[model samples]
Target: MQNLPTSWSTPVGALTATGIGGVAMAVAALAVTADPAGRFLIGLAALGLLVVTALGLRQRPRLAIRDGNRGIVLQRLGGRLDVDRTELRRVRIVRYPRLGRRVPMLEIDVRPPGADDDRLLVFGRWDLGTDPTNVFDALNARGLVPPDPHRTPDR
Candidate 1:
């Protein structure tokens, strides 16, 4: 059997490239565009791209599985969440149709210590910089989550 990675994260290079592109676009829009409305629209789009890049950079190394199967750490906008092995209730891949293609997301259900209800955390391909199915398989290999009998192996 092949060994799988224990951690998954968004590519920093991709985000940095996007930020640079956004800056170039913004500059070009302001310097070359003669129409005020066109410049405003282009600038708005560039700003949005920069904002996304900033957020992505802020949450570097988005998800990681701790050593000894202790838990998984998730970094978000404001802070990080640590979910122990005991807290993890379920992990599965969910697929949804988008633009005539199926997009997969990894859904982790966890009940934190002293928490009465379970919270569902979803990570998309963009978040992991890879297919969620691959992450799911890695989690399964590490025995962090139980195997789903209903899920087909073809994925």
Candidate 2:
């Protein structure tokens, strides 16, 4: 239960994923137990999945309260994610919870090539990039990013 936070999805995300992963392992174990010969195949597949997810888990962002590059080039182990200041299309604190009626999610989606619509950067809601409710503050302080049209607030 302490594996999913309404404000940030870091520690909770990891724990929640692990929990589900354990459950999946148990299911596979059961399937293998019922079929002796097929057990090897399922076991091999599970091992492969575990290896992949473990590598991806290494890319979890740091929660340190400091200013980092406004836009970053993300990658997993060896794969690259398309993200740069120029590719940044929008940044906002999106709400995923309601007062006693819905669950919550803290995320900032980034759009990209062919991926016209997809979540880009997502950390926690209360966890901002910089001072106050201004994520731009983080970027500005970094002094490594340029003004992005998508980051402009609707005034």
Candidate 3:
């Protein structure tokens, strides 16, 4: 399967900030006090922050979705979330209520073999290298996305 291009600004920025903040806090703790217990607690907190930030950076949200041979992969910062083809149920474009207006977003609803409820994966336009419409069209062409019964013909 061909890999889709992706964008990674928002998540990268977040990761960068978290990493810098974590390190700064750790350094500040060392400089602030010489007491063992206080320094220990601060060190622990800083370590926790750094660890969480590192993990998040590895799987940051700004991603790309690529069609795999047997499933679709949500390509993240340094990892990929692979959803089996069988798990995928529907793909549609929806409007999100943001900043008092509706913004277009792609929503993929999936239900794994034994799951009771659907899991939703949402992606913004920036996530895809191209337009969401183009991605949708390509997926639809490959029979990955079923037509929306409620959608009007003009749409």
Candidate 4:
């Protein structure tokens, strides 16, 4: 098997390029379009794209598994969340239908040392720029998360 990366992150270059394209499209639509309704719809779409790009940029390096299997790091808008190996309670991949296709997500349950409650962190394909199943396999290969007996091997 091929070696897996220790970290997974959104493609910043792609996000930046998308944001720039949205701006260009919005500007072009406003300049070239004579119909008010058409310009409005195009502008709205561009705005949505920009918003998505901004959110993606805010959470750079979405997930990272520390070297030597020590811990995992999650980057968020407010700050970073670090979960040590001991704190990781469970890790699994969930699949659900979205827009007529199945989407996979990685969910990690962690309990901070001395914390009374556990936290669930979920990462989607957009966040990881890859399939959650691949991340699950990588984590399993690293022994960070054990194999799930209940999970089918079809993936």
Sliding window of 10 residues with minimal summed lDDT for model 4: 146-155
lDDT of each: 0.85, 0.47, 0.66, 0.83
Error of 2 at 30 (Å): 6.3
- Can you tell me which runs of candidate 2 are displaced by over 4 Å? 1-58, 62-70, 76-78, 98-104, 109-155
TM-score, model 1 to reference: 0.88
- Candidate 3 lDDT, tens digit per residue, 18-76? 78888988997898776888888888888888986776655544443443435566755
Off by over 4 Å in 1: 1-3, 147-155
Best by lDDT: 1
Better of 2 and 4 by TM-score: 4
Comparing 2 with 3 on lDDT, the higher-scoring candidate is: 3
The prediction achieving the highest TM-score against the true structure is 1
Ranking by TM-score: 1, 4, 3, 2
Report the lDDT tens digits of candidate 1 across residue range 3-114. Answer: 6777777788889888998998899778865789888988988998899899888886788888877888899997998888889888988898999998998999889889
Scored by Cα lDDT, where does model 3 land? 0.66
lDDT of 3 at 93: 77
What tens-digit string does per-residue lDDT give for candidate 2 at 29-120?
A: 66667687677666666666666456545544322222234355453456655465556555444444567654333244556767757665
Model 3: worst 10 consecutive residues (lDDT sum):
1-10
Give the winner by lDDT: 3 or 4. Answer: 4
